[model samples]
Target: MNLFSEIRGLVLDALAQMQSDGALPEGLSFVNVAVEPPRDAAHGDMATNAAMVLAKPAKMKPRDIADVLAGKLATDERITSAEVAGPGFLNLRLAPAVWQGVLAAVLEKDTDYGRSAMGQGQKVNVEYVSANPTGPLHVGHTRGAVFGDALASLLAYSGHDVTREYYINDGGAQVDVLARSAYERYREANGLSPEIAEGLYPGDYLIPIGEALKEKYGDSLIDKPESEWLEELREFSTEAMMDLIRADLKALGVEMDVFFSEKSLYGTGRIEAALKSLTDKGLIYEGVLEPPKGKKPEDWEPREQTLFKSTEHGDDVDRPVKKSDGSWTYFAPDIAYHYDKVTRGFDALIDVFGADHGGYVKRMKAAVSALSDGTVSLDIKLTQLVKLWKNGEPFKMSKRAGNFVTLRDVVDQVGPDVTRFVMLTRKNDAPLDFDFDKVLEQSRENPVFYVQYAHARVMSVLRRAAEAGIAADDATLTEADLGKIDHASELTVAKKLAEWPRLVEIAARTNEPHRVAFYLYELAGDFHALWNKGNDETQLRFIQDGDVATSQSKIALARAVSVVISAGLGILGVTPAQEMR
Candidate 1:
């Protein structure tokens, strides 16, 4: 249950009662009223802006309304005290039983404690890590992959029907370059000195594709000109690179529900269909375009071209769909891709692009808006750069990936759990520094370790209890007399647990998975603080000697902490540690 929601309901009900009793005016909107954790724990368990938000609307002083609201709330058994603090804000201290109920709810719900119905099963398409199939996924794509994957999970947990998708950039010149690069590797495999062209991909990853090509075709395509083998090699090499990318993502526990190829849009008449839909709405036009504003391109010149009136939706300027040369611009395929997504009947579309694509956001959003007639919403999240560090120096690039650090490079250094957790420690829009040494370090500074350590500590408690022949399973904890969990330090953990459901809803609303990471870290800190307190206070310990009843009651709280942590970590695509090695 969402304790904050319940308390807010209590406040709203009291406000309605005040109006019924003629203590307040009728027809006051409670839309702006909010119940949230106080900024300072010293203030109280929770705080409400009911009086403050209602004061001016009701033509009454905030303190006067707060005083009346406090009296109404004080009658509730759950609220131990409702003190009007500051000018009008009401701070509430809940009874100990309420916190205990939170722990019991956690044990009953287990990993599903924070699962929400916020999305209401809305169909959401999350497209991410749509890297070119010319090479293995690099560190930049790794961040996007982790962010998108975690976001999909978070949305699904919140009741969205999420589809994880990857858009392959195989219909571009980059794939042509990949083919030529693999052709060179094929020559090398055929016992010939190959020419390593400057424009072609130079990664050693294509060597295997080349060897496979040699084994398949032998010397038949060796003497053939570029025309014959180019198309074949393009298809073959793109698939090979995709395989490498899939493995890289699999290593990090990322799996996509769909792998959409951009090439399919080219010959399949999909691009024309998408453009025609826009044309029907008079969005498509043949017009002369102006040079870019400010410092224009050196080749900038006025030319007649097919353009979309993107500015009519939200873009800064009308964008060209076809160049003056009568060929589709790079953006044409993207528009078709999004149009296809819209026609698939998704309620919302989320694209996770690299930070370098920040300029492309508004135009793409406008395109989706135009295509879907604003029926479907599109949210584009740009994942910022990731800087790798090792030994206090910038980490070097992967030779396998030629000039960039592949996703495998980071995942190999630390396992998938650490990699996934660390990637989300920062917001998707924030630049992250992935230090190999620091991430592996078992300290509070390392969020992944700190959170995992908390889960592991809880497991350790369960193991110790089991070894002592005490029943401490979730079933047992659910039946435990949680009233025995009255210690202030233990209740502090329960209070933190009470915030999980609220935090999940907030994170899903903002489309920020980083908030989950932050919440998990804070919850871990609270649980660890209680664990530390138990060392000096005998009654605070999870296992009370010669008193299985008291020990089970207290261990119930500890197990509840693990339940929420596992759920939060699961949303982040992180497996909670059962034990620390």
Candidate 2:
């Protein structure tokens, strides 16, 4: 079903023939050979570099190799023409029937048309949106959540067993700060003027937490000192904040498969166990770290500490696991968390972190490498910032989230479909400017609208055909007179459809789901172009006036576009629009 892969196989078969004929040396590696779409569509459907890649290795001129390869390829019935272009590249154009088969395959496969097995069912753990459970998720966390969820879906579609997970940061000072802030709210609920400390959270979202605390503890915790209630309130308040966060993610259509707690790593020997695994390998030591670069020696003080030899793996310097005061540094729990993941037997690990955590990437990768003993691979994707705009002006912050916009706020304004699609319009590493005005517009300038409009247009065609008493179902379309679909405009859409399976594998390999969005936009553009051509040429229209056979064939092509679009949108976690409002 993958025309490019099929063509590549033909090219390999031709090379093997050349080896058998003794026209080329035996046992030459063809791994570098590739068959891909030509840079310019007018040149050919696909271009191969087999001849060029094997020229020097086979001790022959590239043009000579291309000439023989082209002759061998031209013998195949599927390949109508194989011409040499440039230095040694072979351009191929497949028969119209071959493109027709692609459309029929689409009808047969439906949403699974572009699904790939490139991942080979490898077990992958994707950890994202591990925000501190202090309040509702904000705009920054929204981007990570969307990206990670979409990535997990993409990997799953490509045959990877993906686990979506979140790491709760409750075992930190931030949770204590949240407890103190809620305690102030509790005092306010008790009819007392509360002290709003400078560092305490000031958001009004915690008012309900305060009222709930009053209902449960009622005056028992009211008069107690800090030591008497801090721990209890910390546990209670973190659970409340996590519930709020879960609701926020649910609004955005995100569901985590696992929610791991940082507190669990404490009160257990997990941290010691992870470090001991490294220490047994001579990676742990006690030493004084050199003063950081670009700082004066007098301004920096070096202290002896327990460190991990992260440099042995890939980090720029050794990292501290325990401070001079003997408390675990932040890196200790992180190492333990990754060690736990490796011990769980996942083949790969992917962490989606905010761009601010860019500095931690190297150390984290080093820790995973050391823990897994190079048996597991870790890929950390850092989602950059998202700047919101409305009416060509900077969007103001939300009072509910205190100083930032909450994910719920964005979803409430534009709904989850638009929110998810617009967030992924850019790559994870690039900063995105999400304009509320532009995203809601119905024009083609909006990618989400354009893609959805294409799907809706296909639905309209099917409905019109149905009303006209023409059978447009897949069962009928699969046996339709597809030879009637010989127009250049119709074949152009089929060509685009042929690229879907290839694009899916490419996107999955690069771990970039934005490529799917981009491809969907391009496919929509091609479909829209074909739709517009029908306005002038009655034969190009999908619904023929009196010919059911031709109408079925054309409608089949349009439906195929929708099938791929729906699959791509599904990977992005965006619902397809059945009709545009």
Candidate 3:
């Protein structure tokens, strides 16, 4: 029941009628036509650009087309007035009954009221928070985790078949370093002063991994050299660290559908297979890369290497797949991973990376393009840094993580709901300042609190109505004579509710879940404004004294607000507050 869509359909029907009456030319494309909310609410409920976009194409003046279109639209019962304004824009004021139907539709649909089929169930793989299994996840990974999880939920809400995935960096040299670090902790647990090397991980989180290693081996490998125990401990320590990471994510309410091991691509033909697929297309070659720009020739040395013709697919230059020493470069495994994703038959791929990885974006896209032959699209979203503040000062780092704040530290302090909601209050590409004091504040300045307070207020209304012996359930609310809701304040809320379905489609199309949070805040503002208005105006109050029918109609609108808030918060993985503490 999208009113904007319905109105757009009416506009299209009118344009077709105009063409049929020979007042307009035949065979004009209406793809550019759009129906959207007017920039100024005081102007109209909705606006359309059909006449403006078609004017030049139809060889007619925009105002002339708008005048004729307005006449056609005025015939519809839903549109109270269609005024041609500003060259060719058509602003429309919908009848009060149209807004009433929006409220009823919200009650009938419940949480699914704004769900959209724009994605059409296309398979999309969202890979995020693929941090190295070295220690607990920090504040940076927290933002990515929250953003990715919310994006996956948003896509699923809009009818995309989404797979939440984590690519483990367990096969790299970093894991070997982790093993040595854990070995030091093992010696410390065995009553020996361990040598804490400069390059070893210094976090106390590995102390348990070391103790676990001691329990498994029982000092047999304690005195052995690196060659004998390195491989065994590497595998064991990575598993332990991954367990810690999983627990951290669980505490933050994130669960991945798949955890891909980077080690799986090793000791197998996967890397070779991925490169061979590219080599078959004449993309692989051995060549000497030109020295990087702005360096003296004497300071730079050229080495022959196995490279992929990434330039053919939009990269700045051809990229090396294998170094002169014959080991695969970092780009090799990345190509193999994306090739694996393409082979899995996903219609699209989305990777959530930290902002530091911005330089890797184009090369990755090039690899996926070459692998899928432009059949699959890859969208990479980079989440910027999060600066934490508390009590007007920078927040202290977590002792457990050694140098950075852990995800659990933030979640434990504010709980998961606040942590997730606050993390997504900004665009992914923009840096976010998360102040602990401000987030916990219960004022309207705090978005999480404001949105939750709105839900809680609606719950309070439902409870009050229930205690007064009024039937306010969905079935009863749906049967209410909604025509009784004619107040301006009440209609303001209904107009906001009508934007939900359209906003859902917009957020999903742009792959931005923060838009949901923003919309919820605006909706809450409208609802709260109307609630405040009832204090002075007796008839504007939701529960009209001694009038059951009118009260039910008003209560119906309040419940509809809660329904949309719950759905929006659900997409953001925030549980709506039943009551504010």
The most accurate candidate by lDDT is 3
Candidate 2, which ten residues in sequence have the lowest lDDT sum? Answer: 293-302
Residue-wise lDDT of candidate 1 within 175-199, one digit each (tens)?
A: 8899999999999999998898788
Cα-lDDT of candidate 2: 0.93
Across 191-225, the per-residue lDDT of candidate 2 in tens digits comes to 98878789999898899999999999887888789
Task: List lDDT for all candidates, in order.
Answer: 0.93, 0.93, 0.94
Q: Once model 1 is optimally superposed onto the true structure by TM-score, how far is the C-alpha of residue 515 displaced, in angstroms? A: 0.7
- State the lDDT of candidate 3 residue by residue for 487-569, as single tens digits: 89899999999999999999999999999999999999999999999998888888988999999999999999999999999
TM-score of each: 0.98, 0.99, 0.99
- For residue 35, what is the lDDT in candidate 3? 98
How well does candidate 2 score on lDDT at residue 76? 97
